[model samples]
Every structure is written in structure tokens, then in C-alpha cells.
Target: MYRTARKVAVMGAAGAIGSNVVQDLLSCGVASRIAMYDPYEPGLKGAAEEILHCAYPDADVSWTTDAAEALTDASYVISSGGAPRKEGMTREDLLLGNCEIARQLGRDIRAHAPNAEFVIIVFNPADITGLVTLVHSGLSPSCVTTLAALDSTRLRAALAQHFDLLPDAVTGCATFGGHGEKMAVFKDGIEVAGVPLAEILAGRAVNGRTMSPDEWNAIKDRVRNGGAAIIKLRGRSSFQSPAHQSVAMLKARIECSAYPWPCGAYFADGPYAHVMMAAPVTFSTLGMTAAVPDGDDEDVAALQDSYRHLCSLRDEVIRAGLLPPVADWTSLNPNL
Candidate 1:
């Protein structure tokens, strides 16, 4: 039966972060109908069962091994379906594996939840996975978003430490390339309390180390590698903040505020790069509307860099049979 009840679906809800996201969504009272989808699972007892057993035994919930069935009637879908970083392998290898997973989810969305809002959380290859989703889901590019903000959040935390201020008080921008070592974290136009970050960091000490652009670069590297660090310690991608972010993203979508947190979005040759960094956008009851301002040259450059990198990853994914090739994204990259 096609139900009228509003719903939210989390792919890989049986995994670490997806479980937390599902938990937070219920705890935060953000979704009345929550669905967990993991088609390869044995049965209803999935990754989330343990959490549900102790906490949300009576909450409205459903677990399915069918992605299409899980997504049906959902207003929003957030997926954390991918392998967490572990033993030695290049990022392209990660994207290849995750792209296949993302492609499967994208195909399910096309068949089951054509109009659903898209918010994917399968890290690292976020920008690339977003591209795969956009291509296969047959949804508007604007409807898709990825977990790029996780990186931005880490950048903000590092800056907060450098400036001797609360993380919330420090705002930073990251230029695009890849989600790895090559990424550019821009301090050129970053602000703290409405002032340049350079000024704010002039007085602080980070573990007996003085702050400098070089130090900031190191910090950004740490931010990019933060997830890998955790995986090393936990043998999985780990959890917590990602789950928190999933809820935050879901609320923004549910409220239609779209208020523009940095994320992954698809690009089709415009003033922006090929694959867009999720900008601060406003979401209304209708859909995604408006791009949040980066408000400067440096921020724009960072995003452009990411776009180029995304295109590279896009080619990599396409070659791996996870996505169709772009004839020539050059026609689509007006900014490049």
C-alpha cells in the first residue's frame, strides 16, 4: 500500500554511522517513519538491531534487505554504504568500491523513490559517489548531496584550536581537489568573529607550536586524514559526529531550510565546477533552493579545485564500471 506517512531511509543502517544516524533521527524526534536498508543482510536483525534492542524497541521502525522497498514512500534518503578506510590502498581504490555501492543505491532510488530527497554519507569519495548517484538516480542534480561537510567541520575545529576560540566561532573554507592529501584548505579568506583567521591565530599556541600557514596546511591534512586515523584505531570508519551530521542534514531537509552546509552536489557545466561542493543552500518544502555564499576569491578557487578533482574521480569511477562516462565535461565546466 502506498502510505501517506512521511519517511526517512538510511542505507547501511546496519553499519556504525548509519545506526547512529538512525538513532539520532529518532532521538531528535525528526522522523516519524524510519527505514533501514541493507539488502545483503540475513534478515530483520540488521546492524541497527542492537541499538534498537536497548533504546528504540517501540519506535516506528522497519529493517529490510531490499533497498527499493526501504526507500519506497520516503521523503528523504541518507546512505552510508561503503567500506571504511583500513589496510593500504589508494583513494581511487576506495572510490571504485564505494561507487559500485553508491551506484546500486542510486539505481534503487530511481526505481523506488524517484522524487525523494538525496543525502549520501559514504565518505572519502563523497564528491565522486555523489556524481554516481546523480547519474543513476535520474533526479535533479540539486536533489543530491554528499558528506563533504564532514571535512569542513574538521577544518573548522582545527581553526578553532589555532585561534583560541570555540569551533563554532571559527569559519573556514576548503578549496577542492580531492578529499585526500591533494585538497586545499584555504586560509586566504577564512574568518573568525568576522576577522581574517590569520589575525585570530596570531596569539594562540597549539601544543607549544606556533600557528602558521604551513601549520594550517598540516592541520588541513590532518582534517582530510581524520577519518583514516579513526579507522586505524577502530578497525572501522567509526561513528558519533557523522551520525550527528546525518540528523542535522535530515532536519534541514525536513524543515526545508537547506541553509547551506558544505556538501557534495552534481554539476553540469555552469559558472561553478563540474562537481559542486555542497554550498550553504536553502531547502524549502518544494526542493533545494539557492546556493550559500563563499563570498570571496579563495573560497571559489577551493571549490573549483574540488570540481576538477571530482571530474578526475568521475573518470576513474566510470572506468571501473560504476558510472557512465561524460562525453566531455569540459563543455560543462564554465569556470574552468
Candidate 2:
């Protein structure tokens, strides 16, 4: 458990994911105070009242439209503020609008809560939005991350189902690169009770069956498109899973867990150098320490390709003036 009391600020506290995140935080007793921010007054008020009524009755809960006020003195600032992806829209389609939202919030957070750890949950291009937040907030890259753990959760669940094992038994499953389709899963690094998952998958009778290459590809595709599949069925992107995953991430960061976990948009340098992309990161009181890739050649190449794709998208956003100037990003500290 965290030794010190924590004040958390949720930037889009009225939105679908934001509301769920607030509820989870209250349920988990993770925050001593929570400041909710949203542009919609009615929704914000309703969410605050409902959350207060249900849990953490004695906790200090407040709502605001002013970003700086909400972020003031916060230990952790989580931004789920952005446009949701509709049925026909890709996550990339939300880039410009969401990036703008992140930029404004980033500036406000920097001004008000410069020491707060930041987590970006804005959609479409989470990696780009995270980078924008890091640069605009003028915070060290280590102080910021995005929710790539959601993807890892989905992948782990998928693999667990395939192997007829509980999700908890499928250890070391990680998703790297962008939070989108280009992201790669490190199957080689995955294990089942300390045994390599690849070895088990290759065995003819392991778990009563073996997963062929084609079957593995199908699982990968499902994990990659899991968000879109949910959107197609429900007419909106996911909220519950994202909220749960975000809360878990906050817990890990607060407790300074040293185990490597998949972080959606942590800073990367070696191998895929100088980018904020999804990768395995060990969190401690000092902040993020990215794990170097030691997977097979194909997996490493895929990870690199994913990094390049994010770099291209980052360049595009910068050129469109949706993100901070390139000079600002290049001048910042490295992902230490």
C-alpha cells in the first residue's frame, strides 16, 4: 500500500471511462481526495454526486471545469478526456481533436501540479497523445505513461482462454509498440508457471492440443482488433476494461511495483530509440525503467516496425501543429 495519502485528479471525470475510473478509485480506496473535471456541468455534477453517494462518503470529492484547479496539488493526474471512436472511426481518426485536448490539459497540469504523475487515456492515438502530454507538460518522460496495460490484459485473457487456463496463469504476456493494430505481442516472453509459452504451444499434446501458427495469428488479430470489435457490437469503444486497467496501473505506480508490466506509451530509447511506445516497464518510486527487448528476431522486428509507425504518426501530428513543436520534444530529458 502507498504510505502517503494521494490526491488524484480525473480530467474527463464525466465521460464513460472517466466515470468508471472514478468509481474504481473510490471502491479501491486509493485516493484521499479526487477532483473531477469536465466541460459538461450537468454530467460532472451527476457523476460526482453518484460516486460520492455510493462509496468513499468521507472522501473529498470535487468537480470543476477549470483544469488547473482540478489538478492542483494532485499526486496523480489521469486524463480520459477526448472524443470516443464511433463505429466507422479508427483510433487514428481521433488524433487531432484528442491531441488538442491533451495539450491544453498538459499545460494546465504542468502549471498546477508539476510533480504529479500523469496518465493519458485519450483515444485513437494514445502514444502520440502521451508524447504530446509529456512535452506540453514539460515533465520528464518518466513522470508520464499511457494505458497499454489494457491491451496486455486483453491479450492475456485471449491466451488464457485458448490454453484452458486462468488468466493469472498466463504470465509475462506483454503488448508493445502502439496501442493500435501495429502493436506486437511478445509470445516468446510469455510463460505459464515459469515455463516458456512457446514451448507449450509447440507441443503436440500440451494442454490437450497445440496452437498452430494460423491459430496463433488468429488470436493476435483478435487482440489487435478487440477495441473495434467491442465498438462494432456496442456502438462505442470500451470503458469498463480500460477503467479497471487504469486503476490497476495507478496502484502499481503508487506502490512502486518493480515487476515489468506492459505500459501502453512509456518512453523508449534503446532498440526502438527515442519514442514513447508501448513496452514492458518496471515501475519503482523513481519512476519507469523500460525493459530491453530480448524476444526472437521476428518479434523484435515487429516491435521496431511498430516504433517506426508511431514515429511517423508523431511527425504527422507535429507537422499539423496538433502537438508541441518538435524542438520542445527534442529538448526534453530522455526516458530514464
Candidate 3:
């Protein structure tokens, strides 16, 4: 349990994921106070009311249209404020608008919550949003992380189902790179009931059937496209699962869990200079500490490719004037 009472702020508290996150936070009793901000005034008020009615009536909840008002003195800031991805839309399709949203929110958070321990990005093209937030907020890359845990969770569920094992038994599974289709799922260090997953899957028949290499590829592809599949079926993007993932991450951060799961798009320096891609990270009061060197060769290669893709996307955003130039960033933070 956390000893300190902290203020948690949600930037898009009216939206599907944001409202669900608010409920999760209150239900988990993680925050002493929660400030909810949404540009849509009515939606914000309604969401707050609904949350209050459902749980934690005594919880300190505030709703606002102003980012500064919500972010003031916040310990953790979650950015879920942006347009949802439509049925036929790709994550990149939502990039420009969401990046603009994140850019302004980052500026406000920097001004209002300069000392916030973590700024979590939950919007689409999460890697880019995280990068924009890191640069615009003028915070260390370590202070920001994108919600990649959803992908990891999806992978674990899919693998567990494939092998007829419980999800908890499938441990040490990790998803790296961007939060989109390019993200890589790593089986290294993964275990099932104290047995290595690779070993268990090797020439093993499950449910009177053996999973071929092509079937494994199909499973991974399904994991990568899980969000899109949900959107296609439901006519909107996911909400509850992502909200749950966000709360889990918040719990890990607040409790200082020793075995923090891998999250998407964490800011990297040293060997992963000028990049914010998915990797294994432990959250602390200072910010996220990544285990970049823990990846196997395949993971490293996929991560580098994802990094290159993110760089290209950043360049595109810079060209559109949505974000500052690389030179400006380097000038501001020479350490990066």
C-alpha cells in the first residue's frame, strides 16, 4: 500500500477509456484526489457524476475544461484525451489530431505539474504521443510512458488460450516496440507452470493438435491486431481493457512493484538514444527505469526497426509543425 496521498489527474476524463480509468482508480483506492479534465463540458460533468454515483462517493473528484486546473500539483497524469479510432482507421490515421492534443496537454502539464512523477500516454499512436509529451513537457524521457501493457496482456491471454493454460501461468511474456502492429512479442524468458514455454510448445500436442509455426505467426498477428479487431466489431476502440491496464500500471508505480511489466513507448537514452519504444520497465517515484539490455537478438532487431519507424513518424509530425524539430530537442536536452 502507498503511504503518501497523491493527486492523480486524467486529461480526457469524459471519454470511454478515461471514464473507465476513473472508475478503476476509485475502485482500487489508489488516489487521494482525482482531477478530471475534458474539453467537452457536459460529458466531463456526466462522467464525474456517474463515477461518483457508482463508487467512492467520498473520493475527492474534480472536473474541469481547463488542463491547468486539473494538472495542478498532480503526482500522476494520464493522457487519454483525443478522438477515438474509427472502424476503418489505422492508429496512424489518428496521429496528427492526437499528437496536437498531447502537445498542448504536455505543455500544460509541464507548467502545472512540473514535478509529476509519471506522465502516462494512452492515446493512439502512443509512441508518438509519448515522445511529444516528453519533448513538450521538457521532462526526462523516463518520466513518460505509453500504454503498451495492453498488448502484453493480449499476448498472454492468446498464448494461454492456445495452450489451455491459465493466463497467470503464462509468465515472463513481453511485447516490445510500438503499440501498433509493428510491436514484437517475445517468448524469451516466458514460462508455463515452471516449464519454459518454448520447451512446452516444442512438438507438443494440445487438445489433440499441435500448433505449427504458421499458427504461431497467426496468433502473434492476432495479438498485434487485437485492438483493431475490437474496433471493427464494436464500431469503436477499446475502453475497459485499456483502462484496466492503466490502473494496473498505476498500482505498480504506486506500490513500487519489483517486477513491473513491460509498457509501450518508454523514453530511452544510452544505447536507445533519441527513441521512445516499448521495453521492459520498472516504475518508481523518480520515473520509469528500463531494462533495454535484457532483450534477445530478435527483440533488439524488432525494437530498432520500431525505433526507426517512430523516428520517421516524428519527422513527419515535425514537418507538420505539430512538434519541435530534432535540433531544438537536442539543444534543450543535450543528454538525450
Candidate 1, lDDT over the whole model: 0.67
Model 3 stretches astray by more than 4 angstroms: 1-4, 55-57, 86-93, 205-209, 265-268, 333-336
Candidate 3, run of 10 with poorest lDDT:
264-273
lDDT of 3 at 103: 85
Instruction: Please estimate how well model 2 matches the true structure, expressed as its whole-model Cα lDDT.
Output: 0.76
Better of 1 and 3 by TM-score: 3
How do the residues 1-336 of candidate 3 rate in per-residue lDDT, one tens digit apiece?
323368899988999999998888877777658899999999999999997787564678889998898999998988888777666877566888788888887788779988888778888788888788877887776677888787778888887888787888778877877777677677778776666656655866644545667777888899889988898999888899888888778878777886446775445456556657778887676667887736678777876776677778888889988877777785544434
lDDT of 1 by residue, 85-155 (tens): 55697766787878887777777787889878655655546777777776777777667777656667778
Candidate 1 weakest lDDT stretch, 10 residues: 327-336
Two-way lDDT contest, 2 vs 3, winner: 3
TM-score of each: 0.82, 0.91, 0.91
Candidate 1: segments with Cα more than 4 A from true spot: 1-5, 40-46, 54-58, 85-90, 172-178, 201-210, 232-235, 258-260, 271-273, 290-302, 327-336
lDDT of 3: 0.78
In TM-score terms, candidate 1 sits at 0.82
After superposition on all CA atoms, what RMSD does each candidate show versus the true structure?
4.7, 2.5, 2.4
Q: Judged by lDDT, which candidate is best?
A: 3
